[model samples]
Target: MFLTHGMNESGELVSVADVKSGHTNLHCPFCSEKLIARKGAIKEHHFAHAGETCMESKSTIQQTGLPFYDIATGIGKSDIKLLDKFQRYDNVWLSQKQAETAMYLTQGGLLEPSPNKPEKYQLTRLGRDLVKHHDSLLQKKIILPEATLQEQLFPARLAMLQYHDEMNGTQAARFYQLRLQALLNQHLYVLKIHLQQGSTCFPLIKVGITSRSELALRISEIKRDLQQHGEVLSIEIAGLYRHFGSLERLIHKRFRASQFVIGSHTEYFHAIETAHDLSLLNLEALGKRTVEGAYCRTTYREHAHKVRVGQRKAKLLNNTHLGRPAKNAENLLTDHPDIVEAFHASLSLRKANTKTGKAINTVRKVYAALKESGNT
Candidate 1:
């Protein structure tokens, strides 16, 4: 239904939505509607069904582990054993879904807690596929957590000292916080947020880690810094590294899969959004959608990962009047001896229609340029 965003006492922005990191079944937050219709009359959102409940208000978010829930739903294809990666996020977690969603978001945005529930947390799903793939595919690709880094970060005091010696207190804190990321990338536990509130007034941030020793030392530092300066409110270490990546895959694949979940939840969650934007639900409009992705040259520089060779890529190729010439045109032509002949042949076949002709001509010119440059 509606999207909700607000600032906490700490001034950090918080957003609430049906599709938020902690939510399942992308409903209209306000009305609990499965669909939303933005009211042009006012900025606020409403349900597609006028009489239904609207989105959840700022204070209404239930404390249940929801991200974990979403992950479980999407995990239809992954292994069941993979659920262990999420245990670190919530010691009391009892469901498969919460852990899965939590794992997904931890990689996308930094996970944080509801001030109301300091022990619980939510984050962006950076690498979210371990739970979404079919068992065969999931089982074939997975990795386990690294124990060494976990040990290194285990000693809070030591890490604190290294952090201090390696960087200033501020920088040390930052580095210590980031230490969990290494484990996370490897599909180990992720850092959980420990929510603590203070009354002082210094710029501060919350950090999370896996080890108690490390957490203890880091918390002590924050407390000490605030007490000494008498200028900052107490900062919190709300969470620590729970398990990372898809555990089911790791167990099945024996940690041999790729390091990312581009096709996992991260991919699909994004796909749900992007598919709608790129898709033409109307069968009649399929060509339009295809054309949009393809010939929509407006964004020639889409992210390397985002732009796969889809019909859109082909459409773009079809619409192009100019080929993207090779950097070393001469060398390309020389290296590929058939380039000149192909270009000439292609050029001769060009029709007069702008759309198809443009593409053919583009190929012709690009190769021609290369041939001429190569001879130079």
Candidate 2:
């Protein structure tokens, strides 16, 4: 098989697109042998060993030292789905049909039998790494479309947007484009938290965003908070994301009907009742334009509605003829209440544009008005 990814001198995965067709310095990731880039128009670009093909590259069973690439390279879609389930939930009991896939993951060292329940399986360190590094691994694929790679990287791109007191038209356009990309790339997760209220004990799932680094700290905080009600029986990370605050708000809205409030916390929902809707939890499906898109679309509609309201407010303020016509800069500030609120909250004009869906010109005008008024 042709290698889709090669390792650079720095030991980072390099796709065929990252290099030109020639005797390059890239090495086969599995065998560490020098590789030749083949970017001919006749076939898909990939890496071929300059010398004889190593046994490791020829066989799927051979160790590559990169467990994620080694395990992911051979797995089918169903197998990947099974792995996702393990990553998202704790103590996953496999069906007879799923058992075959589970066995493959277990043999690949991605999963292990649950200590408490042998029938159940849990993600091993390797398995967790596979899911965590999924985006990077997907980018290394020569077969996957560039659009797909961009979609997967949408969150990172959005998170990198720089916030300034004022932004130009181009910056505003880039911000809006990234926000739209974020809507399309929403990745939802179910976090199962075991809670005890009075004499009854049950599991409550919270749909939200959290990174791997913060997950342990979050669980610890939850455990500390529930000390009065009852000890947290268990907590499991069903999924994770980086800087997905917008996605979290959308999820809260989607699952609002199923929300259950415990004391001051309203984020929890009954796990048993929410299980029926869990079929929508497929990571691959969520990343595509599916049910997740519907949720994001609803959010976009809300934003659009707010924008229309702002425009109407601007029109009304302009035509009010209160004593004298309001200054254009002051009118913009009055029109976009969200921008005013953002300013009151000490947010920069660039951030206000992002938060309020206001145009860069509007944000700039409002910001100037605020500056003149000594309110900034």
Candidate 3:
């Protein structure tokens, strides 16, 4: 992401690049955490938190106006209702897994857990205070969309779909197919491409958004257009956003002042220079992958999710690990003498006794380090 705000020598707010070359006390305006100025070849210069997670980061994410915030406020809304509403309104959505993870992170006090009602978690004082503080820092107008009475009372039907239930191969495939179809039918998407030909001058990026139904046709049109001018190097569907027009406008506004604009077409920007800027708008670009890779991963996740549910239900039945950490080398060595003996036999018993002893010690050290996540 392009650095939106940063601090300088005098602790004054400034753009990231405006910081003095030798200045080392720069900090993020949002979190007041130390910021690193990254000017890598592939990515744009930006301010990243020194720590792994930052409250500012969460506050900054655009959530597409999902009602999970309502859920965060202790409202009694089912996961199914939220999912359906998002789909129906074509609002940006948080996957059930993602929402659950967020709730887990704040459960103790940041978020008040409802042990009596698992689905109804509340925001504790800390959570409410943080929300209030963040709101004070960044105020916005909220415009609730108009909906029918059925939509307002849709929570009652939340239990209609068993999407979260465990499934077999066939069930998972069917679910994936239906879910993918529903997703495509519900929202539009933005497809980004690096339009270049070896014979052409320089590569330019094109960002276009279209309904999922029109995605194929849009791609074909783009290909024909590019073929008329130059060859198409590659196309990457950067993100899938429910409000495509709004997202497109935001992206365009972000790169409007970029210095790398194409001479022929103002809409196009230098692919390499403007990549990070483009990426920042594509929130779903996390863990970018080819289309096929994404499909395979989704399928794998379906299978894995089912297996996990089964394991959790029958804890005593899974003997695969024998209740030990599956990858713990020390436990494996202790339980299976043959593996240790094989390592011993590999090092000659007579001529290489000292080397064998060292190997054994090294193995122990390696296993210990693996478990403790430390270097000895």
lDDT of candidates 1 onward, in order: 0.32, 0.57, 0.42
Separately for all candidates shown, the number of backbone clashes (residues 3 or more apart, or on different chains) is 58, 1, 0
Which of the predicted structures, 1 or 3, would earn the higher TM-score when compared with the native? Answer: 3
TM per prediction: 0.19, 0.29, 0.30
Ordered list by lDDT, greatest first: 2, 3, 1
lDDT of 2 at 45: 62
lDDT tens digits by residue: candidate 2, 1-376: 2565677888655656446678889887557889998876445467889998876565522212111112232234565678788878775667887886576566556678889988788887656654555535433322223223233323222222222102222243232342243333433345888887778888888875432335676667667867767868888987664333334443454467788776555667888876665544333332223324212321232344576677678679885333334567667766777877888899876788889888977777787788788884
Error of 2 at 128 (Å): 39
User: Any idea what lDDT model 3 has?
Assistant: 0.42
Please report the candidate that would top TM-score against the real structure. 3
- Judged by lDDT, which candidate is best? 2
TM-score of 1: 0.19
Candidate 2, residue 218: lDDT: 66
* Residue pairs clashing, model 3: none
- Relative to the true structure, candidate 3 reaches a TM of 0.30
Cα lDDT tens digits for candidate 1, 150-216: 2222332223334333433333332222322222332112212222235522222222222232456
